[model samples]
Target: MHLLGRKSKKMAPLFLALVVSLMTFALAVPAIQLNAQKLGEGSTTIQSPAGKGAVNFVLDNNNPDNLIGVTVSFNETLPAGSIIYVKLYNGGTLVTSASKQLTADLSAGSGIEIDFTSAVPISDFDRVAVVVKGPTIQP
Candidate 1:
């Protein structure tokens, strides 16, 4: 019994260190919040004059890589200074985005391809959103 007591005393410092290490690890790890709501799906109503047609998010054919670009066809020509915004989402979390402002008018029924800089791993994101903002009207 005395020998066992002596062994335990020798192990005390090591046991305390292990406990401290575990506590440190637990503190270093980030906690996932269950209550917080993540931004998910978004829906927008398209008016009559301007309509969003077929959209394809695929790998660029000209510069084939792991990255992807968007090919969109609009019903009508988009005006100059119009802005196009593309967003990639993995579940509710936004993965990446790209925005480009039109320098000239886009012709109707022409498939326009918009590229995203630094876009990679085309398979990672599941949701793709595209928004086009027309040039402001002057009174």
Candidate 2:
């Protein structure tokens, strides 16, 4: 047992030196930061012709993140009691959808932002289409 203690004491200094070297490396090294650059034209917009009931806009966000929201607009004041649907699609398959009811106070030619925060996993080169369904857009 005494011989074992002597051996352990001899190894302790080596272990302590290794630990100190690791600690110094950890403290001396600087942290690396990463960030994603959003594209200048990160969104898509489409104008619905008169008498058309829907406006289809395809946004090929060949980007790093899935679409988060959309801003819809009507050439004229949205009809009262209008039911607008915001549909998201990927490669002809429907992913998710959202809806908004037009109020009297909503002005014409203004944008209606819809949030689709819960979207499917989107990768690069993914084709995401946003279809806005509603009455004809007066223009």
Quote the lDDT for 111 in model 1.
68
Instruction: List per-prediction Cα lDDT, in the order shown.
Output: 0.77, 0.60
lDDT agreement of model 1 with the native: 0.77
lDDT of 2 by residue, 1-139 (tens): 3655878999989999999999999999999999979755556775443232324333336743555556776665565546667765657777777777666534566666666656444552245344434554464
Error of 1 at 23 (Å): 54
Error of 2 at 135 (Å): 8.6
Best by TM-score: 1
- Give each model a TM-score: 0.57, 0.42
TM-score of 1: 0.57
Cα lDDT for residue 107, candidate 1 = 80
- lDDT (Cα, tens digit) per residue for candidate 1, span 19-82: 9999999999998878867544586664543486667766756666566678777889888888
